[model samples]
Each structure stands twice: as C-alpha cells, then as structure tokens.
Target: MAFCTSTDINCEPCLYNSISVPGKGWCLSCEEGLCQSCVDSHKRRLATKNHKIIEKCHHVASIRHLMSQTCKNHNTILDRYCPFHDDPVCSLCILEKHTNCKGILSLDNVAKNVASSSSLFSLQQNIANLVKNLSQLNKVRTRSSKQLQSDKIVKYTSVRAMRKRLDKHLDTLEEKLLQELSSKAGTCETEINNSLSEIESKTKAAYAVQSNITLLKTMATDVQLFLAIRDIDTSVTTETNWLREFANQHNTDELNLDLNTKPMEDLLRTKSLGSVRIDRIPNHVPINHLNMKEAQIPREAMCNGIDQIQLYQKIHIQYHNEKLVEILFGCIISSNGDIILADGPSKKFTVFNEGGNHIKDIHLPGTPSDLTEISQGRIAVTYGNSKKMEIAEIKDYHYKTVISVRTVASCWGISCDNGQMAVKLLTERINLYDTNGLRIQQIKVEESCPHYINDITIAHRHIYYSYPYQNSVFCLGLDGTLIWKYESDFLQHPRGITTDGYGNVYVVGRHSKNLIVISKDGQNGRELLKCNITPWSVHFDKHYNKLLVRDSEGATVYKVAFRL
Candidate 1:
C-alpha cells in the first residue's frame, strides 16, 4: 500500500544503454524495472518469458521496497522460495544450496497473503504486550528505587535511635553503679568519724578521772579514795571490753572497689547491634509474558476441550522381583517429573523418573492412603488406618517426616493448594489445615455421612471430591457450598481425582478400570482411556501437561493436547 517516491522508481535502462526510461512494468525475476518496449522484448526472450512481471502501478509501488532481490553468488533474481530452508533462491542458487528442499514455491505466491495472516497479527500483538510488560516493569523498578532511597533514610534513623537508646541504658547502669559506690564510701567515712569522736570522749573522761585520783591521794581519807577508785575501775573495765570487741570485729583493710568487667567485655566483643539482611522476595509485578508453547496456541483454543491424549511413557511401578500387591493408594508427580507412588501394602513411597526408570523407595512410618505435593520436594500424606497425617520432605532421593497433623478420625485422601490443605477423613468431614499442619477448620459433608468421600482435590478456589458409594463426583466452593454433582455410569467407584489447566477434572474409576475426564461444569464426562489393570489412582501434572494413571502394579503417562 505504500507509494514509491524514492529515486529507484524510474525504469532501469537496457543493459547496454545509457538512457533511462519510465517503467511500464516490474520484472520480479530479473529484479529490475521494464519500459513498454522492454516489457515486450522481455517476454519475447525464452529465459525471461516465464518470469513474473507485474504490470500494475500500485503493485510496482508496493514491491519497490523489495530492493536487492538477487542471489549474491549467482547474481540472479531470487524468484523461488524454499519452504524447508525458509529462504528465497534463484535457479542457480536453488540448485547449489537448496537442492534437497521440498515445497519450493514462487516467492510472490508465498508472500502474497502475509499481511493478512494471523501470524503477522500475533507478532504485532506480542510486540505490544512486550512493550506493555517492559513499561510495567520499568515503573515497578523506578518505584522500588525510590522506596530504597526512603528505606535507607528510615533504616539509618532507626539505627541511630537504637544507638542512642543503648547509650542511655549504659548511662543508667553507670549512674546506678556510681551511686552505690558513693553510698558505700560515705558510710565508711561516717563510721570512721563516729569511732574517732568516741575515742576522743573516752580520752577526755580518763584525763578527768586521773586529776580526781591525784587530788584524792593528797587531800582525802581512805573511804573516799577507795570509792572513787572502784568507780573508775568499773568504767575502765567496760571501756576495755568495748575496745576489744571493736578490734576483733573491724580492721583497717583497704576499701578498694572491684568491678566485674565480664559483662562489659562481652558487650565490647559484639560486632554490630543487629544484622541487616536483604531477602529476595517474590515479585509483586505481574509480567504476563507467554512462552513459546503458550504463544503458539490460538486464543480460542485455550478454553477448548482436550483434543487428544498422547502416551508419553508407560511405567511398571513394581520393584524388581517383588510380588504383586493390591494397594497402591496414592500417586503424584514431583516438580522434577519424578513419579512418586504411595504403596499401602509396603508402607513406602516408590519413585520413578520420566523415562520410567526406578529411582528410589522411601519408607513411611504409617500406611499412606493419599499424598499431595505441598511444595517443591515436600508432600503431605494421609494414613489409611491412623488418625494422623505426616508431612515429609523429599531430598536426595530420600524422604523424611517433617511434621504430623492429628485428625479426629482416620485420614484418607489429601490435597493442598496455595497455603491451605484439605484432608479427607474417615468420617464425613474434610479437615482443613495450613502448610504447617495446624488444623484450621473442619468441613462436614452432610451428603456422604455413612460413606465418606474417597478422594479429594482443591484447585482454582474450588474443592472436588469423589463419593464411591454414591457413584458421584462433587465440586464445592471453599466454604463447602455445593457447586455441582456429576453422576455418570462410566465413572463407577471413582477413587482418585485431579484437575488440569483447562479446569477439566480427571478421575479414575477403580471398578470401571478406566480414566475419565469430566468437563469443568461437571455436566459431561468422557472416558479418555481404558486399561486392563484396575485404575486405583489418577494424577495430572499440569506443569508438563501430562496425565498419570496408576494401578497397584503399573502406571502410564500421557501428553495431553487441547483443541478448539
């Protein structure tokens, strides 16, 4: 649609001529413009007779931008397009470089409908989405930068405030210690001063007694002298005893203050008041970027029913030389595409890789009835005959119990999503717990009282379960409101249930020996596959779009595709 205004719009003259002429047609194969006489002569030649030449002015205008449309090696116009190599080639170029390429067509035909193709539109939309995502991320990063600046100031102020508080606390301790030292020193000084005053009074009384005794010896009779002497002796004896007791109890030892410096030394050894750690949290900004697989699907196909099931791998779960068992109660796929099966008879979990090779076997404390992965390498398991569920961590091909949740009745099936876990109990109740195994609530099922719900799964804010005796599948909201109950003859005694990205429910019928996929509305059901072995459990790995159907002895993985 673009008009030609460049200098190349004029006619390319004959190869041997020096004159230019107005173009009457464009030779796509020759990669040159043709005047009226040149157009007649071009079609007369045998080599150029079959070449595509556009005679319209608008068509020439559109193709004027297809500059330098010639093979570099052959110096020939690139007229043919090799579909296999995805390149335009001349006759000589195709013979040399793309001889084996198939579906080679004329370049003009190949590019005629490109502008109206869905691929072009999709590419444009992808570019737009990319720009929008970049803008969002840029805004988030800019805001985060500003937040970092503000947080830096706030953190600095907080640190300074803590230092000041520490200084004040130390000052208080120092003041209390100094005050105690001063009080003790003052008491010592007062005691010494009181002792000095008492000594001085005693000395003065002794001098008075000596003067009286001297006067009596010179001028008084024997009776007066004797009475005075006896009174002085009594006073002297009491003073001597008091002085002896004081000397025994007290000594002039040095009043040195010894401070216990251990606490101060420990304080000085501290490196910092506290640590400042930077933790990388999940990004709050949603970057809606589609990967290759998601981007290739047409928008309308996203909500369509599953088109077909392609078998990916078939795995025989029995351990080497082990006798056949009848109780493989639970099956799940780890994040690494490793299949983990809970063998009730063996009281252990068996692991196998995507290639159907046996990896390892992990022993469980109790018989596991159902298991679900709560996070990467972590699973919550419900025991069939026990009143507790064990949370275990899978590491280095081994598993260890992390925690346990106690139930009022025996635990059966378990499913976990987001941070919440829904565990099916032997009674008609589902015990809800957090990831840490703390029971938060109990959802009582009034529909299946005598026969409890067999398997349970939670997805997309909805709780799904199977009632084997009732021969039905029930979907309920998180608050236990019934959404739909699916009853079908094909789903006889459904034991295990799971969901896919399209919200389609996949369940296994133990008695029917089939795997059936129900619609999201629970109004329709289709048996995806039937097996010779009775299917005990079913699990769908949404990450890889693979289906896992398991029995006591074997399991199969299928790659699922959806169609509009």
Candidate 2:
C-alpha cells in the first residue's frame, strides 16, 4: 500500500505495534494502552491487587453510560465503590438504615469468589436450564388441556345421541300399550251401556199397565210370564253370547259375568301375575388347575425321636411302663405340637409337645373322655363322668367355653364334621348337633349286641363309631343310615378309630396293641403296626404324613411317621 503514514494511529505499523495488541483497553490510571494479558499482570502486583479490574468491552461507547450512572436509591454519583455502604462511597449516598449493615463487600471481591467456585457456576447453569424446561412444559400442558376438552365434547355428543335413541324406543312402546288399553276399555263400556238401556225399557213398559183392574190383572199376569221368559233367555242367550264374544276378543280362556256374581273389580284385585325366573347357569370353565401329586411315602422310617408317619400313619403313641393302656377316646394337638391328653386316668388333661416339652395342664371337672378341635381355635371336650360336653376356644393357653350341653348318657366320644358335632353317648346312641349347639338328630345303634359306643371319628360324610364289647366298627351316613359294619376277627377290644384323607379307616385295639388299616370301601383290611402298647386316640395332622397316638397307660404321646 502506498506507504501508510506511520504517524496515523490506524495505520498498519500502529496496528502491528506490540503494545497496541487486541483484547485491550485504555488504562486511565496507568495512562497507557494495555492488553488483557498486560492488565492481568499489573492487577497481580501487591499495590494493585485490591484495585477493581473489569473486562474491557470491545465497544466502549456501548458501556460508557454504565460507568458514570449512580444508584437511584442512594442518590449518589457513580464511583469506583459501592455507593450503598462504607468505604469511599463516591458521590452516591447510602441510606442511614443500610449504612450499619455488616454485609458490605466490594463487587469485584464477590465476583472473584463466585468465579473461583465451580459449584456456583454449575448451580447457576442448572437454574437457567430448569427455567427453560419449565417454559416448554407449560406449552405442552396447554396443548394437552385443549385436546382433552375436544375429546370430552365428542364423547358427550355420542352419549346424547345414544340416549335419544333409547328414549324414542321406550316412548313408542309406552304409546302403543296405552292406546291398546284405552281402546279395549272404551268398547267394553259402550257394550255395557247398551245392555243396561234395553233392560230399563222393558221395566218401564211393565209399569204402564197398572191402572184398569181386570184388564190390569190379565196384563200383569201375562207381563209377569213374559218377564220370566225374558229373564231366562237373557241369562242363557244374551249374557252367554256377551261373555263368549268378550272372551274371544280378549283371548281370555275363562269368562264369568253376572250381576249377582262377584264384581270384576274383586277378581282383578285378587288376581296375581306371577313370574318364574330361571337362574343363569355359569360357565364351568376353570381358570386354573392345580396338579397336586399324591405324596409318596418313604420306605425307610424317618423318626425324629418321635415316630414319623405319612398319611394315615399313626402319629402319636403312648406307652405306660411298656403296657398299652386302653385309649378309647380321641386326641387333639395344639398349633405348637403340644398334645392334649384325653380319656386318660390323669383325670386331668396334660399337654406335651413331640419334643417331650410339657406345655400346660388342664384340670377336668370330671373324666374328660374325648377332645376335638372345633372352630375359633377351641377344642370340644366331653366329660364322661359328668356326662357333659363343652366347647372352649383357647387363647393365651386359657379356655373360653362357648357352649356346654349335658348328655343323656356318659359322653364317651365327640367328633365334628361339616359344622356338625356328633357325641357318642354311653347309651350306644350318637346325638348330632349343629355348630350352634342345637340337637338336630340322633342315631341309635340297633345291632344285636348293642354295645356301648366308645369312640367316634367323622370323615368323608360318614361317622365311624367303635362298639368295644362287640369288637366291631359301624359306619353311618350324615342322615344316620347304616352304610357298613366291619367286624374284626383277630382284633379284640377296638378302642379308637380315625380316618385319613384317602378314606382309609384306622382302628386301634388295646388288647392286640395293633393299628388296623381298613380300606374306605371296606374292601381290604391290614395290620398297619403292632406295638406292644395300646394305641389310643389316633389322629392325622394337616400334612397327613404323620399320625398322633395317645396311650392311656403310657401317659405319653408318640408321633409315628409312616408313608402313604
């Protein structure tokens, strides 16, 4: 270029001057043009360290107004100090109330601390982003609200149209029925009025010939005969024709209309239109099926010191010094595996777990012959000597009797099935009662022996009772029908009996000290176990794998484990 004037400030030589570099401002205090790097070094000097150093705006004219402006509240001229507080506040005036505040600090100092903290910048950025997101969310909410309002209007319109159609159909049906009834009533009324007018005319003519004596007598006689004939004809012809016509028109199967007969009002009032409604049959499709395989019993015995038996396996055994005591009554186990001794000479019932832990002792008013778990966590106990049965719910190892009944004979055994309790009285009769303690029925043993009923076990809609003297077990249905009687040949003195879920009957004989397993259908019988002691009060647990047996002489309970 034609040799730029070196004297011009805007000349290439001036622009290339090292001191006139970019990103710089005129330093008025230093009276020199300084770049940002040069000013930074000058600010770090010990004397200028506390001085204010702001970024230089590339356009000085744009920020020039801010440099001289004063804070309006302080009414002070712009200065290089905070006009609101202590230090050289410049021409700006600080309010008296704010002058004493201790929070005053230089703006540059505050900015420097904030800039040095990365967390402060991150927080500021996050706040700004959140504000932007909130604006966008507000627009989305407005759009969704508009759409919802439009959808509601559409649905309301459709509902209104459907309602109108339904109302129209109902109105048409109502109008048609009303018209038919009105027409029928009008026709009947017109016919009745015409018949009444004809009868009135005949009566008026008969009254006209009552003046001349002899002529009136003949007229009267002839009129009477004519009236009688007319009456008979009216009864047989007119009334009958009117009834037949009315019946045919109305489709009435029966019609009877007579003035002396009962009024139509009475008939209408007495008539009742009944309807038979058939219940809707439900679909028998099952939503889910449970494939429960029959539990298999292990061949080897699994005894936990206590005998472990599977379903129908004798779970409890009691030995009294190696002699099997006569266990003729029932037995029950608590939720904690404690056994309640029943019918033993303990005269008092004792509770013990399978681990031989004695839990409680229940003193009896009389000899408690039988025990069974009823509802509400209670057991039904029958006192043989007292001839009374009581149901008690157990809570906190205490008894709360809900019902009590005195037996006609010594209560020997008690059993519950299908919410009904059956008590075998010593009189060889089983009395049945509802769960409410109301006697429903009674079953009397009619066998030739008529032995005393010692124990009763209910299972699968049948009651099995033992006849101790007869050495037989009788099976009876819910209605007391004798289903079958099993007479034991080898077993003598069958004391107690229980049933398994598979309908297998188990009988324990004290004399033989054996458990007899009989098929449900009375097809086969086998000796399940032959212990030395009498197996009394046999019961199956929820698992049906183990049996609980109580020995009267042993005064102990045994858990016998047997396989299915």
Candidate 3:
C-alpha cells in the first residue's frame, strides 16, 4: 500500500497529497512531493539562490529519517532553519550565538516574525526609497556641474574676442605711425647725402691742383720746366682768383646749411621727444546744477577803512525792496561813477550812487529796457515797445534825452567805445551809432540764434554780448563781423557781461546761480561764486580792481575782488 507524502516536506507538494495544505502547486523537479512555493523561495533566498531541490517520495522511509536528524553544531533535529546561523540551531544556540542579530534565526522563528512584525516590511520599503533618492541627487549634481563649466567657457570666449579686437586696432595705429616716421627719415637722409657728396667733390678738386703744382716744381731745373714756369706765373694769378671765388661759394653754402639744416635737426629732435609724451586733449566742463545761497550784508565790515578791493571779497550791501526801484531788465556803471538801471515795464531809467542809494529817476517815454554807458557822460538806452534807441546825458541828478530814433529794431544789448555805441537789435542785426545818435553802420548776423541779448561790453576793439537764451557769449569786430563765439554749458541765462584787464570775460546768470569766468580765448571756463541770488548785472572796476555784482531778486549788491 502507498502512504501519502508528509505535508511539512514542501507546502506545494503537500497541497497535492492525500492530506490537504494551504498552498498548492506542481513542482517540475520535485515531481513526487516538492512544492512550487518552496522551489520559488529556494531560488530567491540569498543562501538558496543556487540550492537544488529534489523530489522526495512518500514511499521512501530513509528520507524521513534524514530530514529529522540533528545538525552536528546545534544538537537540534533538522527542521525549518536559518542558513546564516547553521541549520537546525536550537533555541538555546540562537540565544547564545545569534542573540539580536537580524540574519540569524530559526526558520520557524523567521516565519512567525514575518507574519507578526509590521516594522520589518516598513524597513524594507524605506531602503528602496533611499536608493531612489540617492539616484536623483546624483543626476542633479552632474547636470549643474556641466552647466557651470559651459558658462565659464562662454565668458572666456567673450573676453578673448574683445582682447583680439583691441590688439588689432593698436597694431594698425602703430604701423601707420611708423610708416610716416620712416618716410620723413628717408627725405632727411637724401638731403644729407647730397650735401656730403658736394663737399667730397670740392676736396678732390683741391688735391688735384696741388699735385700739378708739385710736378711743375720738380721739373723747374729742366729747360721745358723753365718755359712752363714762365707760363705758370701768368696762369697762377688767375687760378688764385678762381680759388677765392670757390672759397666764397663754400662759405655761403656752409652758412645756408647752418641756418636751414641745423634748424631741421632741432625740430626733428623736438618731435621725437614729443612722440614719447602723453597727448591728452582738454574737454569742456559742464556747469553743475545747484541752488543759490541767500544774500547777506555785513554791517560791521561796512565801516572799515576805505581800502582797495582785493581779488576776492565778501562785501555785502544793504537792500530794502520798498526803498529801491526795481530795474528788471539791465544795469550799467558810467565813467562818472553813476549807476543806471533799466526799469522796463515802468518805462523809466533809475540812477543810483555807488552806495546803493537811489539818486534820480529818468522817465522814459517808451519803456526804457537796456542801458550802456557811452562817452561824454552820456547813456544809451533801448526801448523795447517802441523798438527804438534813445541817447541821453546824465548831469546833477537829472537825465536829458538828447536823441531818439524809431529806425532801429527792439534793442536788447548796448555797448559803447570811444564815442560810438553798438546796439544788438531784435532783428538779429547790430547797429552802430555815433555819439550824436547818427547811424554809422548796420551788420546782420548769420543764423538767427534764439538768444535774449542781456548785456554788452567792448573789449580789445570788439563788441562782446551775452546770450542768455543759448547760454553762450559772442564777440564781434568793430566792423560788425563775428570774431569769436563761445558756447558755455555752465552758464544759465547769463545776463551781465564784463571784461578784466587780462582779457578774461565775466558773466552773471540769474538762473545759473553763479558767477562764471571764461578765458580770453574761450577755451577754459569756471564758476567763480555760487552765493549771488539772481545776479542781473556785473562790472569790473578798473580803478578799484573790484567786481561789483548786482542781484535784482534780493535787491542787493556784492563786492567781489578781481584778479588777473
């Protein structure tokens, strides 16, 4: 009779046995009794991946005994076991040797723990998640490293490109300059060679003459020599004169060389020296935009001894708006020490003393706008509304209008010379008049510039006018031709003009809030003072060597020192 296989031999084989089991499958190798579940576990388990499973026949009696025999190391009958700690290890061996180790345990104990412990599954899941996280982090690091390297390469390429362009430009400039120098050197060498060749030819001719003379002396004893000597006396005088003429020509040539060639060598040396020096061109400096400071007067300093004005001073004048008549347009100081201010809208001209005291009021019939001091204690005033000019005389606190004319256009700038007056008309033409108000000449300007001519002064036989609208100043010759023009970025609404003894031009601008000093050649300019509020007029007093600045807004005057 055939007995059924043991269910504990393998779960799958036991399932097909006469006795029933939970898992059921047919194992190909374990044909008689081995189970498919056991075969799969044998292939997957670490120590069992290479293990061979064989069929165990339930009819074989010896196989059952072999499976039950105890392991030599553990003294426990073979049962389900842990391969890591030796098969069939007893409970006592497990406690002593395996203790709390994870990989050492009885198969029955492992099975029971796997079923009961949820924490074991959780640990396996966490291990898998950690591996995935590490892979992602590695990928990110590699990508960022590559990007950084690429950016470095790009930046290096750009820098190299710029360097190459600069080198090319420098090379081109150097080559061009060197070629020019070489050409000049060649010309100088040719001239020197020609001069030396002429000197060498003269020396050779002199040696030839001496040789002929020596030969004649050696043959003097012979009869032929005696005849030759008689002929030589006659030729010797003519030869001497020819030699003197040659000497004179050589001296003249040498003098020319000293005068011309020596200067060329000196010039070349100077140029060579200049080439090594740095060449820098001056640039125009722009005006700084800033507010003006408040005007103040020093009462205690006013009583100081009457001293000559210095190069720079801080003298202030007392001002009362109500006590002083407002001259809105322009002002000028006459040779007789009288101050004339144009009261434009009021149609009157106001006169004041040097002490800021109002002296007289000249009621102008046609809006007295601008004023300039001419000769013979006379003043030239412009009428804006009537578009005419008026010549007047100032004497004993009164003004007598000598002449008036409607032929001239609206006058903005007025200047005077010995006995003549130059007026800048609104029609962009400058009209010249004699002391008797007779029109002498008229000159039309090119390019109608948008400038409100504020003040005019005569200097160096030219008429200088301030153009506040364009922030510039202009100079015209006595014949009404443009001599020079200067554009100042720093001058704002320049209304007043004055010239110092050294030819420097000074202008006062109301909105610019500063006094501007320009060089005579109009090359350099600078802001001298930033303390005047709405400076409307400026005067350079030759006798006192002082700069008088008048401010219409503050109704005050400031005394500044003038220096060359």
Candidate 4:
C-alpha cells in the first residue's frame, strides 16, 4: 500500500526490464524492488554481486515510505553512513558536507544485527514500563471512585436519620444537604472520568509502539529496524517525561464526605441538621522509570574532542593569615579527584576534594611555581628561583617529601607522565627528568620562545606549553621537533596548558580571562569558558573526565562532555 493504489503497483515492478512482474526482493543500494528473475541476475552481475537485498515479504516498502531512502538535500539514494555526524548520506552528500568526516561506513555494515542490539532491548523495556505505569494509575483511580461512592451513601444516610428526630423545619435542611452531597459526588465522578480518558489514550499509544516493535523484530530488515528505533526512542522518552510530571501533579487520592452533625446533637443550639464536607486521604501510585543509559549512548568515542563543559563545583581557598598574600599558580587533579593548588607567594599547597571542600594545606620550605602528579596519590612540585622540584605523597591532610631534583635554571612549569617529567625553566629551555631525578634530555626554545613559557603539559608523546607574553601555544615531539603552534586573539596571555589525551589542548588565558580549546592539528580553536577574573592555571584529569582551574580568588571544577 506504499506509494501505490493497486496490488500490481504496490509491489514495485522489476527494474531490470519493462515487465510488470511483482517484485520478490528489495535492493538496498539500488533502492528498487526486483522480481525473482531479476534477483538472480542482480546477484550474478559484477557491480551488484555484493549488494545487500531484503525480501519484499518483509514489508520493506513501508520502511522506505516512513524513512526516505533518498537524501532530501542531494535527492539521491543514501548508501553511506557517517558515525561522526550520525547521519546517512549519498555520494553527493559525502562530497559536499562529509569530506573530512572520519569513520564513514557502509549503511549495510552499520545496520548489521541492529535488531539484536542493546538499543532495541532498551526500547522494549521502556515501552513495557510505560504500559505498566498507566495500568497502575488506572487501578488507583478505580479504587478511589469506589471509595467515594461508598462514602457518599453513608453521609446521605446520616443526614436523613438526623432529620427524622427534628420538626418540619428540619425537612428543608435534609433536602438541601442531599443536593449538596449529589453535586459534590458528581464533580468527583467527572474528574475521575477525565483522568481515565487520559490514561486510556496513553495506554493505547504505548500498546501501538509495543506492537510495532514486535513487527520490527519479525518482519523488518536490519536497516529498517535501525532507523525506526531512533525515532521510536525519541517518542518514548517524550511520553515518559510527560507521564512522570503528570503523576507528580495529579494523584487520584481517596475522597470522603463528612456529615458535620454538631447542630443535630444540640437541638436548642441551632435549627440546621448538619453540613456536608469533603475529606481527602493521600494516595500514591509509583512509576518505575527505565534506565536511560541506552538513550544517551554516543555515536563516537569521547577521546575525539571536547563538545562542551558544565560547572560542577566551586572551591574557596582559605588563607590562614591575612598578611600572607595568595598568588595561585599550579593546579592538578589527583587520580581520586582531589584538587591541589600551589600558592607561590604564600609558599603552600592547598588541597580540596571533588565536592569542593577544603581538606588541608601543606607548607613548603620554598615557594612552589608548579605541580604535577607523578603517580597515584603522589605529586611533584617545582619551586621557582629555588631551582628545585620536590616529589611528595599527599592525601587529605598528610604530606611527606620523598626527594628533590635540582635544576640548572629557575624551575617554573612542570608535568609528569609514565615516570617521565618535563620541567620548563624561566629561561628558554625545558629539561626532561626521570623518576630518579636524573636529566634525560633538554629542549631549547630560543628561536620560537617569546621571553618565557608559563606552563607545560606532556600527553600522548607530545609536549604542550603556553607563552603568555606572545599569546601562543606550542606542541613538540620527544626529539624536540616543533609539531604545531597555535595563536588566537581570544587566547591572549595564555598561562596553564594541558591536553585531553586525544590531542586537543586546553589552556587558560589570563589577560583575555577565558579558556580556549585548540584542535589536534592546531588549525582550529574556540573559547570554552569566560572567567570572571584572571585564571592563573588549568589541569585536566583524563581518567575522571574532570577539569581543574586556579584563579586569583580560588579554583573550580567542570564535568566535560566530548564528541569527535
């Protein structure tokens, strides 16, 4: 019945010849239906031999009608799938829009066994829960309706029995009380009926989706199932969120009528028999929500690039003495998510937990310029002008120095990865050191450096550093080969620098008062965060997907979301 009025037309004719024979199979790439004779010839042809075909009996024509097989922009058959964009495209679309997209796979491969995937399983569970919730809510309404009816009759009986003991004046009061009871009961009934109508409508929709899922599992092709599931999941999520809000606002609680017969007990006090009033008893029906992890599944891995960031927590650094000035410099997030900041002017290392609560402060013999995590629960700090780097184990309020490495020039920026350390000097060179404090190699930046390098980070075999005076960031290989240099007007006076391990660099700009993220190749960059004050340092914890930034007043943490 798709795009056709007659049965002969319903089954698209074989594309190989002019004959109007009913098609027995559908070719995905060709986007055409074929007869049995053409199906055999299609598989035998050299160009179409490996083409994926679905049986016409599987109702694939309906799939094509529901989800267009052709790209609307290019007006051509969609044969390729781009995981980067999460879109199906034609050859023309690839040439026009997806030329640089990575991981572009054939549609057939992406749809392979999609019916048996976790996405389908989650969809099934979500719809089933929706039906259950609607049924339970309906049950509550039915119980409340029966209780209301029973309570109304009892109140009516009490009013009439009380009127029997009084005079003719009481008869008028009885009539008035009965009318009030009926009116109140009618209103309750109307509300219940309206609620039932809503419940029934939602239930019918849930059942329709459940039935379609069953059909998909049995009669639909894998590609058809894949496309249908995405749309179905979106609909289910909308319905689920609406139902949750509705349940919170409108619960069918039990209502009862109370006959206030105080006047009836004291005949001399008043002429009225009684007054009818309503009493409410709280009732609740639960809705079990499905786990939404499947709905949030990403198309690509997170190591590709950062999509955005959200403020997670804020920490206020405390200064014990008002006279001691706090000049925050180095920042790092331990493996367990503890934030450590070095205050050079104060000559102390302040620590905080993931919840932004202060843990402790460790005083140092010399002023620390920067710090880096050497291993789990262990950290190394660089002292500016002291020409020394101290390795220590820190946890909460406990701290102990293990060893100190002496540098030739004043030590400034420091980073450690896999037992190797890269320490930047106040001069024009970076000294590499091992765990035993022995110098392994040195890199000279006299030609490219601009006065001084403020901070450095090493990740994935590349050294990343920032130059605030020049408003630039640089990446270098192990052999001191300059890979790429990134400069942007938005990143003026860059200070702290780090990487996401995927090659994207994160740096803080002091004068610009913002954070900038540069792409792996350094050809593209964007401002990520606009700070209220000058930010002095930044550190990224890849294991926990957390970012730490040290500013003039205090530090802050962010939960990062990444996409390729």
Model 3 stretches with alpha carbons more than 4 Å out: 1-328, 554-564
For candidate 3, write residues 374-399 as lDDT tens digits: 76477778876477887887777567
lDDT, candidate 1, equals: 0.64
Ranking by TM-score: 1, 4, 2, 3
Cα lDDT of model 1 by residue, 1-564, tens digit: 112334344467664487677787877556578888889989999988997676653344432433345466887766776544435678998778888765577766544433332323343343344344434444443444454445545655554454455555455444444455445445544544555455455545544444444443443323223222333444444544454454344422222333332233454455333334332233444333222222122334445554433233445554421442444387888888899877776778888898888888898787788999999988899887778898889888777989977788888888988788998888878888999999888887877754444788988888899888978999988888899999998778888899986688988888888888888888778888887877777888877677788775677776665322
TM-score of each: 0.56, 0.43, 0.41, 0.48
Where does candidate 3 have its weakest 10-residue lDDT segment? 288-297
If both were scored by lDDT, which would come out higher, candidate 3 or candidate 4?
A: 4
The TM-score leader among the candidates is 1
Off by over 4 Å in 4: 1-9, 12-68, 72-75, 79-106, 265-275, 278-282, 291-564
Positional deviation of residue 350's Cα in model 4 after best superposition, in angstroms? 20
- Candidate-wise lDDT, in order: 0.64, 0.50, 0.51, 0.74
lDDT of 4 by residue, 1-564 (tens): 012112232235443345577778877666677777778888999999898776654455434543446677978776788754567788999999999876677876776666666567777888999999999889988988998889888887777677778887666767876888888888888878888888899998888778667766775567667777777777887888878887777556676777776754575456555567767776677666554332122233333344533333444454333322234368888877777777777778787778778888888778888888888878888888888888887765566788988888788889998678999887788889887678899998754453554689988888888887778998899778999988898888888899874578899988899988888888888888899867878888876556787777677776554322
Q: Ten residues in a row with the worst lDDT in model 4?
A: 1-10
lDDT of 2 by residue, 285-404 (tens): 111111111221221222111132322222333434322243345576655566666534665666667665667776665566788776547778887768788887777666667888
Runs of candidate 1 exceeding 4 Å displacement: 1-144, 147-302, 306-328, 449-453
- C-alpha RMSD (angstroms) for model 1: 36.7
